[model samples]
Target: MSASISVIIPIYNGEQDLPGLIETLRSQTYPASCVEYLLVDNNSRDRTAEMLIAASEEMATQGITLRPLTEANIQSSYAARNTGIRAANSEILVFTDADCRPQPDWLTLLIEPFAKENIGLVAGEVVALPSQNLLEKYADCKDVLSQKHTINHPFCAYGQTANLAVRRQAFEQVGLFRPYLTTGGDADMCWRILQGTDWEIEFVPRAIVRHRHRATLEELRSQWKRYGCSNRYLHELHGVDLQRELKGKESLRRLARWVLKELPINTLKVATGKGSAVELLQTPLDLFSFNARTIGQREAKLPEKAKEIDRL
Candidate 1:
């Protein structure tokens, strides 16, 4: 099989995660000769560039083309991904994050749907990596990074770029990701493809990427804040009205219920050793997520017309 697929991963200060990511790529069941790995460095300040160079040299003899590209002018991951998209030499492009570890068959299954010409996008499952940390456990319990929620979204089904694949032809037709978009670019891309062409999206649960959950409260807050920013972008760019957001008194009441009711019950359960720490942490995590997202949404501001569309 001629190089039919290119895996694009954007990294910034990813030295700690790159080795494991490279190992997982090396272990991919997909034939190395038929795929290229485009690792785009989004202006990392650490040893990420040197590490990528070392990885490229080491993996070269393995028939794996590990190409390292730099997106210095643009600091966004989306910008880095756009760079990879332009440099890719394949008809199909697969995307994942540096912090994720794909199962051995992840690549094989991820690109399998592209056999059908009409399949424009494929999203695999994202499962949290096992961790003893409280926040990580809470995230795992809540399925925070799972693609199921996005794939089943009411407004529009989409995929997270953490484990998504797209047909190059369809991708080009829809145009590249908003180069400067810091969040929600994946959803925007998928929506564009769906609206612009006759292409379809697929969800393959077997093609799993193990994502590291945020181990700290600060990390969790940051993640949700980005998600909130994404919500705003989607609304401004695509007119996706997120009705799920509770506002004003409703939001306060929801938080109060968690604190006044569920917290005590879960605390007692934990005290009795009948409930997992995961359950106890859920309430606080929810509160943190809500506040962070609210802040992000309030902070996110976009141009009046971020993307062009005819309202016909």
Candidate 2:
């Protein structure tokens, strides 16, 4: 049978967590014969390579293949994924991280939306690990991970790389991912596709997976810094005037954030939303802070970020 999907998992030092991801896929409700698991290992110093070798041995017995592609100079997660896409054999390619475990029907649900010809990309949600720590709690509070992809938007394309599937033609047409970006690469892809094309993107809530989060406050700060840097890069790369647009995008969300923290809400005469009013109000503060953290060293942040990538 022709492969229905190529499950591309890119790794750096995924270690023991990688094994569970493969196991979860094996237990999927989707026929195991429908996909090939392609694991891309981008130069790990840890036992990631060794562990995958062991896992592949067991997979061999079950008539399944866990192929590995190792390379030098592991740049970033986005680069690893691009490698996987290049190596993929299936026309329908799915990308996920090794740290994430799919639900039994994750693959099946993700692919079902593609029954329509114009549906070029499919984006699913990322469920976070529930934890008691402040950082994890912060992420849980800020990122409404439980929110489903609203199908009403025909242009629905915001996707996290952890759980996304795209047709080979659309991916090729959209020009794949910008290798220059370390983060926000997935967002970049979505933006490029929507720039103007005869493409349709669908959101599939059933295509879900659990994502791992930073365990400590320091890691959380670093994550934010990287995020800020990505925001800066994306704004510039896309020719977006973030200074002008951010305040128009962030206020109410920030106020709601303050509300969640039990802090004081700044404004009164609150208006209900169908638009970006609240975000517009809050974005300036975020923009200033983002710029402060990003500093004049936005260029320097990339190499600095390159150093922090010990992807386990």
Candidate 3:
């Protein structure tokens, strides 16, 4: 039977997670036959591709299609994912990162919302995978507690990409995610869909996955920097007021709150060179300056393009 839905796993050196991920999907309540599990490997250096091949062979015995696609330097997961969608032979497209392992009911829970013809996409819950790592704890707290729900409206007032699934039809309408988006591709894609058309994104809490944030302090800081950089690009492309995403007054308030609640954490992070505790003081000043500069860049970009058009 042809696939009704395809699950796209965009991988990058994610060999570590393959065994658990493949096993979890196999364990899903959804028939292994109904969903084509597309393991799109973006040039993994480790055993990811090989592992997928082995898993495919094993799954083939059970009549499951564990399809694998290979490509290089699709440096962005956003690009890898769109490639997988194009390669998918299904009406619906579901996405989860290589690092997240879903519960057995994940696919069934996420796809059930599609019964409403009006629903464009569905987002599942991302729980924190049980880990001894502090980063995992932090990720779990932020992702699970801070999550929001949207049934048929803009869903990403607070967004993280670890647990998002979208319709293939929505891709044709909204266009694929930004290729240059390094980290906030999930937010960029959601915002793009919202800007172009009205599509309902159902947030199902029961359809959950565990996010495995296997990062040290250094990794966490690097990831945050990448996020900030990507946010700037996403907001610029979509013409969202950067000041709002940054939330100038709110950021200051948050900084104050952070100073109170996170000073000790900052001390550890700063001592380890993970972040700048001193820079934390400059946050309010930095927020204003950063907003000013981003606006300047936005304004400057317009004239440069206008000049090109004038010469043409």
RMSD to native, candidate 2: 7.7
- Per residue, candidate 2 scores C-alpha lDDT tens digits across 200-307 of 778887678987677664565566566566656656556543322334346566656656642323243233343333333443334443544454325424443432
Q: How much lDDT does candidate 2 score?
A: 0.67
Candidate 2 at 82: error in angstroms? 2.0
TM-score between candidate 3 and the true structure: 0.73
Which order, best to worst by TM-score?
1, 2, 3
Better structure of 1 and 2 per lDDT: 1
lDDT: worst 10-residue window of model 2? 303-312
Residue-wise C-alpha lDDT for candidate 1, range 213-297, written one tens digit per residue: 9888889889988888889989988898853554668767877888899889988998999998788667656877888888888
**Per-model TM values vs. the true structure:** 0.93, 0.75, 0.73
Query: Each candidate: what lDDT?
Result: 0.87, 0.67, 0.67
Worst 10 residues of 1 by lDDT: 303-312
Q: How far is candidate 3 from the true structure (C-alpha RMSD, Å)?
A: 7.7
Q: Highest TM-score, which number?
A: 1
Order by lDDT, highest first: 1, 2, 3
Error of 1 at 222 (Å): 1.1
Q: Give the CA lDDT, 0 to 100, for residue 127 in model 3.
A: 70
Whole-model lDDT for model 1 versus the true structure? 0.87
Q: Identify the superior model by TM-score, candidate 1 or candidate 2.
A: 1
